[model samples]
Target: MATPDPSITTWEGIGHGGGLYEQGYIGMAHGWSTGIVSLMSNYVLGVVPTTPGLETWILRWAKGRVGTPQGAIEVHWTLGEDAMSVHLTVPAGTKVNVQVPVKKGQFVLLNGEQIEALIEEGYVNIGDVKSGVYTADVRQRGSVACKPG
Candidate 1:
């Protein structure tokens, strides 16, 4: 079966009622809100954890969609003097992709080392990755000033 376009579908709410025999009534429906939230987190944010305790991570900018039209997810926090890190988990055997904001002359570091990346439209694209927990650190011109905080 084909999935309906959520943008134009009318979300129907399940209802419950009772007569002289039943003593329960239905509450207002809120499925629409739930579906929207799922779409954003699963498709837009694309940060899915597979392991029960978040032992594996998957970083996909936008999956099953053309673009992030809703804007990218941003997190800002300080780390001991000059350290910043992000964490995520994904299921095993699943291909993962990550989108990192980048500029010319900058590179991506997987584990304190530089790796070949595709630079496009002010973003660094990493693809063909498998399921696993990952921590990435970005540096510009050999400087750590641009690290996430």
Candidate 2:
């Protein structure tokens, strides 16, 4: 039964087994368990596999560290008014794609160098980025011409 304050109650809702009110106090908070695991893996750890067997993957570029068979991958980013500064460390032999949020026609930069491609579908699609530490930053169009690389 819910108390008037609700916060003062000893139990929350019915038990996992469904409405056995007499002995309904199940121990674990199920919702929080899922949040701590699933949410942590996707957003914080930023580990979303795009291909099977980890041959290639997508890095969402949020924060935190994750370990793969090659080694450890760590990413940290700082958001600014018009750009984001990302410091990334990828395991050797890994090839991953990086997605940065942006509007179409906007430009993207890695280590202060402009990328030739424009943003598509609300993101700048940077693909097949090799393993290594990098300083990535984004710049808008008209700031600098994209150099042929």
Q: Residue 93 error for model 2, in Å? A: 1.4
TM-score of each: 0.39, 0.52
* Clash count per candidate: 6, 0
Q: Model 1, poorest ten-residue lDDT window?
A: 18-27
Best by lDDT: 2
The list of candidate 1 runs beyond 4 A from truth reads 1-86, 144-149
Cα lDDT tens digits, model 1, 1-149, are 01155553332333243221123243233355357665676566676778765588566443332223333333321223223344434445454577766666666765455668777887667665556655555566656644232
lDDT by residue (tens digit), candidate 2, 1-149: 22344544333345456544547456433453345555676678677777777688766456877899999998897665555667788899998798777764456777667766666778777777898987667655565544323
Q: Candidate 1 at residue 88, lDDT? A: 35
Displacement of residue 109 (Cα, Å) in model 2 is 1.2
